[model samples]
Target: MPGLYLIPTPIAEPFVLPEYLKEIRCFVVENLREARRFLKWNFKDLDIDACLFLEINKNALDINEIHVFMKNAMAQNSDVGLLSDAGVPCVADPGAVVVEKAHELGFTVHPLVGPSSLLLALMASGFNGQCFAFHGYLPIPENEQIKKIKSLEEESSKRDMSQLFIETPYRNTKILQQLLATLNPATRLCVACDLGAATQEIISKKVRDWKPEKYNFHKRPAVFLIYAR
Candidate 1:
């Protein structure tokens, strides 16, 4: 069973550790400190120094580093765990490159079940789940963001699909404002914030119904979904 394991870390408080985690001694992660802290927090008896941790650059994943990591793990016949900063690995994360490299090397990849903010938000959005798309992060510039929002709305209307995207925690409010101002009045918007946490909130309403003054998701992790049909 020496292969690559895609492990999920908790997105919020009240972490749940899978039993298989106890067996992983080698890890490929976005942040070394966070990964170590996660393991140590979940397993008090785990010897951090004895484990092998390879950090992947979140912004720009290096294929050379990934190849070396996978090659070494395969050569040693050791199980390697892939960890994201939170939630499942690969989805909306640079860890996808790691998973891709693992496959190219003909290594077994096991994906463990865990919370994913995108799926969770879509499930609660009351939108067309059967036909949906996750666009990851939209353009940051105000004009570009506005244009992207409009295009996504049009695409959703044309296909009767839901459009989902996320933004930097600090830019949550800014994106919300752009979404409200640019989308048609009849378009439905869903904002799921602080998912998996005690402060979790999900609100779905038409563009015209959203009350900007009543909500503040600034600096809070959130997912935004839109459906025009």
Candidate 2:
């Protein structure tokens, strides 16, 4: 392999799917110290001495530093793994930079089928799955958010782009509330939270249904979906 491997780690618990941990190398890991602790707890018996590993700590690295690290790693290895802080890699997450770099360098990449909250939410949404689109995340600014929502809804209904996206954990509720207030009330919304964990909750409800109650998505990773109005 002369490219990259976009790996998917558990969104919540490390041991959610133990098999995935043994399949590929892990890189761009958020916490090196914690990862060791986690593997020791679950895969202690397996020999992981030769696994490829890299760290991306927010406290230690700026964006450029991380980019440089990725560029260096991507040039030297073909079968290196890429991961995120949570959920699936590069879906409103990290690993995009390295994957993009790999593509530019003509490296063959493999995106393993794993715990993708986007797909899980879409499958649970009961929405028309024959055709869909995952447009990643929306940018900041209220107008931009509304515009993106409207565009996604229009595309999903008319142009057929099933809106699949997410936000930072802290801003998830705000994003949900915005969609509830700005988008059509009848729009089908699927909220997959803490996916693949004991507290995993996939709620396929209307925008209005979600507004009545306050939601706490602080400690949880969330995937949101809408199949147009």
Candidate 3:
């Protein structure tokens, strides 16, 4: 049976795809244009014209189509690769449903090593890594969002675990402000911005110390961590 390779794409820096990517003939991508560009950027020596690209993002996911694609590829003993726009595939990203379908059809799943903003930020954070929780994204409503932040802070203090979350790049500044305003002033917050990229920045400080004057996350990708005082 052919295997389903989960290829971790680069987050911010230039492509550092593994040597094995050269062997992949088929790929499931979140964004077609970016995937093509990624291939050209990383595997400069390979023939880009010969590869197959399949789209499976939130807006355009067809299970029956994916099953057919996988089964046919498997019959040929050709491995199909799954690529995410950033970080690892299926971790707070698209591709989970496809992976689940792959499992249902009994295809071998192989995940390769790559940069993950969650783990990278956690490693840089002084919070408890042994027991932490990743709450993908916060609520949208103002009151509900603040309530969630406070709840995360309480849970962190009670369990001595860390609370992690992410915000869309455009809303980065708003979320940062919310974190500073909602969390306890003594609570330690870690803000990892543009992780794995050239302009990457990771800082851990108490909520009271996060001066608004010098911070602006307007359109930058970032991860957030919260822990007890």
Greater-TM-score candidate between 1 and 3 = 1
In candidate 2, stretches whose alpha carbon ends up further than 4 angstroms from where it belongs are: 1-3, 13-28, 38-52, 57-79, 103-108, 208-211, 214-219
Q: Candidate 1 lDDT, tens digit per residue, 1-229?
A: 4788888889986576876678778899988998999889888899889998889855666788789978888888888999989898999875888888888888899998888999999999999989999998998877888889999999999999999999999998888888998999999999999998999999999999999889999999999999998
The candidate maximizing TM-score is 1
Tell me the number of clashing residue pairs for each predicted model: 0, 1, 0
- Candidate rank order under lDDT: 1, 3, 2
C-alpha local distance difference test of each model: 0.89, 0.69, 0.86
Over 112-152, each residue of candidate 3 has an lDDT whose tens digit, in order, gives 88878999999998889999999999999999999999899
User: Candidate 2, residues 1-229: lDDT per residue as tens digits?
Assistant: 4546666666555534346545445456666775555555666664666665677646544557556655666566535666665566777665676666667766688787666677777877788778887777788899999998888887887865577887888888788778887778777788888877888877777776774475566657887888764
Q: Model 1 scores what on Cα lDDT?
A: 0.89
Number of clashes found in candidate 1: 0
Worst 10 residues of 2 by lDDT: 15-24
Looking at model 2, residue 5 earns an lDDT score of 65
Q: TM-score for all predictions? A: 0.95, 0.71, 0.93
